[model samples]
Target chain A: MSANPEPRDPAGETLLSAAELEARLQQIGRERYHSLHPFHKLLHGGRLNRGQVQAWVLNRFYYQSRIPIKDATLLSRCEDLELRREWRKRIEEHDGWPAGAGRERNEGGIERWLVLAEAVGLPRDYVVSTEGLLPATRFAVDAYVHFVREKSLLEAVASSLTELFAPKIHEERIAGLLQHYPFANERTIAYFKRRLKEAPEDVKFGLAYVIREARTRAQQEQVLAAVRFKTDVLWAQLDALHHAYVEPGHVPPGAFVPEGPQEWQASA
Target chain B: MSANPEPRDPAGETLLSAAELEARLQQIGRERYHSLHPFHKLLHGGRLNRGQVQAWVLNRFYYQSRIPIKDATLLSRCEDLELRREWRKRIEEHDGWPAGAGRERNEGGIERWLVLAEAVGLPRDYVVSTEGLLPATRFAVDAYVHFVREKSLLEAVASSLTELFAPKIHEERIAGLLQHYPFANERTIAYFKRRLKEAPEDVKFGLAYVIREARTRAQQEQVLAAVRFKTDVLWAQLDALHHAYVEPGHVPPGAFVPEGPQEWQASA
Candidate 1:
């Protein structure tokens, strides 16, 4: 939205200063992140019902389950030991180290996500199997994986900067879920509670890497586009969710359906 | 919506009768096709202005132009000469044969689509280049291509059965576009008018192929899921359009933005 002719140089400078680049990256978050999506607002505002929430948790597990693989794809592509060392921690966080192994966190995000799924009264096997994921969920998550695997390393790292915006959503989610849903205790929503801490750590490294690496004007443009693409990946999942589970609800064929006493009554 | 305990084998039959299968396919269309999407309703009912209609055409061109490529992928995977012979016509219809090379139709759907794009006032090259497509558009179309490439042959064929419902929507679209938009004369809307005659040819073959090949309950289930998947591909594109162009529009960072006398003033 800036009046600058060059998209990369908003200030019309030769190269963006690190603070400027970081500001642009944060601007992408403010303008495009899924937390700003209506579904997210509905979610954090506690406007959705249990079945809708359950549908979200179930579909989101597809994305949550794929993070480690996306990280692993990034790790596979990078040549720098220092970057790899910092990045390997993300893989471990999502996929967890072995039980007896000396890692900071032994229980991966996926396991914790399943815990939340069980708390939502979904069968654990169904959530873990991802049998009931929306087609949109699968496509969006797979796009993230392929984007990391295929895009330039700078772009890949930049895409991960959505994590830059994740902690606030996590905080809001924990508060909203606990206040509104009976299932939202520390044990069930621990995944988000942990993400409040973990995302900042991950994005700290990812943000700095993209800012430092994307030096050229064209590279900066790619980095910006990458972040935008990531935001779409996240936002599209919610669009699908809102369409299927929200008002005028036409749940897509073969997706999760709430059982037992009709938990979802479309709010008029 | 059926109360059957088992999703498949509703009658405890080994396989559905062809009539029964056709009915089920139509049912899927009634419930899930993009025709039922709010965007579709908006477009057909004259609720959307020219800019929104242009956005739909432009984004949809991404899907429109890729039909041949998707068909060729299906053709490549198929070993049956009869099936391949039938399928290759789809590619020819979208991409067209070399001018005067003796193909029935020289101007393909893609060219016809550009006519629609021009009628709507988008620059022809911009629509053709697909530079303005939403990330959601690219991802959803790419997912369809991948679905055809990777799924079982029968599933690929089954996904194409969304065309079964196409003639009706095309008829409705032609009527609505002609009635509402001044630019909707036959010359500008040739794409839909052409599809009215062409889609039945495609779906007639596609439907029969699916019913014949999906001989087991399990195969029938896969066929059903494939159609559902196709509907999601379509419904997701409109969701992207509606979210980006409709009320409280948060057009994702780098997607299409309508230019010219700003016709879109978001409804309160």
Candidate 2:
């Protein structure tokens, strides 16, 4: 798992071999990913009140709704059949494939997140509308979309390395939300539960592609920076939530103000 | 200037003529542009301290640096030679034309920003490095880049309608920065000064294009949404700056923290 502990050569000014570059990327995920953010800690720990949690869910829907679009942008830009074939699955996964002529459940992550939104008591239409999510959320998610569309293909693939760290967060979220919030249940947390399986597969393909393509030092650096930028995209969203809903209470004008009475019983 | 005050048609179902759509687009700029953000109020009124000013210059550099890239994305996507010919000038303006094909002091907006960066006392390399800018700045600017790259050609043209509002802001900035800040001079503020001339030309073309192309109500609505999305992109960056550098001071972890001593009376 430790691909290369030291990613430098004797000359020290040039390329790290693929394994070494992978190791460096893992280092970035460890240090910079939003799993370490305080908002996640607060959410997972049952510390945030219902309104605050609603704020998180509403803002996060903005991110969730955009994932397939981001994936499609990636797929559109890839020319190689094999790469496109592999990447196309991501779009199908986030935006579900047509139900096999036999199967009934043909929903995707966005739908699953909406189930969570309903469980959390937000009207489904409002969540879908993304009417009042934080300005920061829109900016952060749109930035991710832009990053995928504009960056080099290798760098675009490299940015998805955040997936390498996502499974752990999903694991923690599944356990934590189930224990901490009454509304959290098998159906409600399905988004995170499904991601636990989906993300590792994604990271496997993405990490290998980045390691294989980043054949030079400049490329390795760009790959690393792309991952770092992706982390910032995730972290900035949490910062916006924390600043607005958590402390000092300075929400920007016209963002979602948490509605409904303070507490909720477990929904059936 | 008021092209059509009422954009709605008698049937209330479809199509705004070109003038009506132009008026609606201008109305968006009037209401939503970042020129209306309070951070700009502080920035132009000389209320921000030196570090805050430096932060604005450095962060805005990320935006200035990407303008040509966004323009190039537009050019790459365009099929029309005449449109590309007109748009190529924008890319060249941000990234200066080739040297000694003619002129002296050939500079792009990026370099002009560095002049402001230097006048504001940031190291040019540091400003260019873009290491310490707010995460929000990256998110906002990247959103604009993505907006240009992925949206419909009509929507892409419409988004640039923000330019229609730019000349007035540049005029305000020139007068305000000069009167309020010692660092302000013709050379340092050249970015704004030049834009006053360039933007009107860009706007003339972009406005005509959006107005002429958005023939359907649905298209007009998309055009309006694109401009509003652009305004959000601009406003979100200022919200990030204000939250971090101004009152209640919860600077996000790892953003630029002002290091310079506070208050400046004419840096002779």
Candidate 3:
């Protein structure tokens, strides 16, 4: 057997020349995001049974719940008003503001996620509390927050470059889930609908921020590593889901488990 | 399938009383710790061929190297000079005083661990650098440092409670390694010999500190959880070892693997 391979040197060049940086960022997402994860394939391809679907929704809700917190962490780190103004929109999108005329026009991504969770038969309170999520998920999510808090702002923004590929994955998920799971309709898929437009705009803004800001080779490498780490965070979540749920009988102790056919509704 | 089972209340009275707390801490070690790990059993039993042993030593040196750092974190957090004095012994034990004619004992636990590494066919430089250890190993070890730094001083002391069980395991390990692995002998087992005497004394001091400090039930629970978390840290190290070296073809990307079999020689 061979020794451990060295991590690729993303800092060989003096500068990534903007276009190269963007391409490199996209390449990382292409090669490593959860969209490429096998569990995601099984999820979007109508292959998993109901129990497996339930497990995915339940586990993913934890991830969904943490997004605003991660974004808020990034918000806390930025010194620029323009950056904060742009980033605060993300938090607002996840937790939308109230509209006038006694109607809330935008109910937020988190609210939409709860509807998706309900479609998969999870209790909204349990989904929101995220007490049932895997330890790996918690670690992975916390690692993202720690990354933002610890790393350079360029790297921190680069970590969000996964958004570069999210729109396509969001579309695939919406179509796949709608076609396969009868319980999942347009209202239940509202999260993806919002993300499809929102992700591209977010990616455009974050990419521009990283490209313009990452001036040194070391900073560029940090950006790449941050993106790679964020990818690992996403990949590990899928790994935990696959190991615990899809592989039946390998569930870790004190992790969520799908109830039997007779007891599913009662457990929910 | 069944729903997720609740964690059983570790069935017994609160380990509030000193004797009961000591017993409960020992029970934690009995249930956890690397001695009970499958990889440890294989190594001590001679079931692992030479290459596996090499990988074990190489990966474990990462852990051996971190003990002082974790202790120093504890020392830094402590406000009382007396407590720091006691904790300083742990640092001194792991990182010996400077060398000279009248110098205090110069070689430390880290040095002795290098001898163990040399016995198992790893180069001292490679062992010291920790260049090729598993990502999971780094995560687990860093998590320990984070625990000590972030948690209450009582919880930090409780994490060190694993030392209370270390003497028994050290004796078992020393006997088993000398009897089973031809490359291992008295010189190589020196680290374990030192630990046999050191661990119990260290644990006595740590337990007293934790018991006196952890007055509230929440604090007590945090202490218990810290031990469990520390146990997970140790357990995760072995898990990485088993996955990389023992279970053929299961090594995750970017981890150590032994080279061609060759006797490691200690050089001046």
Q: Please provide, for model 1 over A187-239, each residue's C-alpha lDDT reduced to its tens digit, 9 standing for 90 to 100.
A: 88888888898888888888778777876777888888888888889887887
Candidate 3 Cα outliers beyond 4 Å, as residue runs: A1-13, A45-59, A101-105, A121-132, A175-183, A242-254, A257-268, B1-15, B30-60, B100-106, B114-133, B175-183, B188-190, B237-268
Leading candidate by lDDT: 2
**Would you list the clashing residue pairs of candidate 3?**
none
Candidates 2 and 3 compared: the better one by lDDT is 2
Worst 10 residues of 2 chain B by lDDT: B4-13
What does the lDDT read for residue A13 in candidate 2? 56
- Candidate 1: deviation at residue A39, Å? 3.4
lDDT of each: 0.83, 0.84, 0.76
For candidate 2 chain A, the 10 contiguous residues with the lowest summed lDDT are A4-13
Among these predicted structures, which one has the highest TM-score? 1
Model 3 deviation from native, Cα RMSD in Å:
8.1
Candidate 2 per-residue lDDT, tens place, B55-102, comes to 888898999998898989999999988889999999888887656745
Residue B100, model 3, lDDT: 73
Name the lDDT value of residue B49 in candidate 2: 87
Model 1 misses residue A28 by how many Å? 1.5
> If both were scored by TM-score, which would come out higher, candidate 1 or candidate 2?
1
In model 3, the Cα lDDT at residue A58 comes to 80
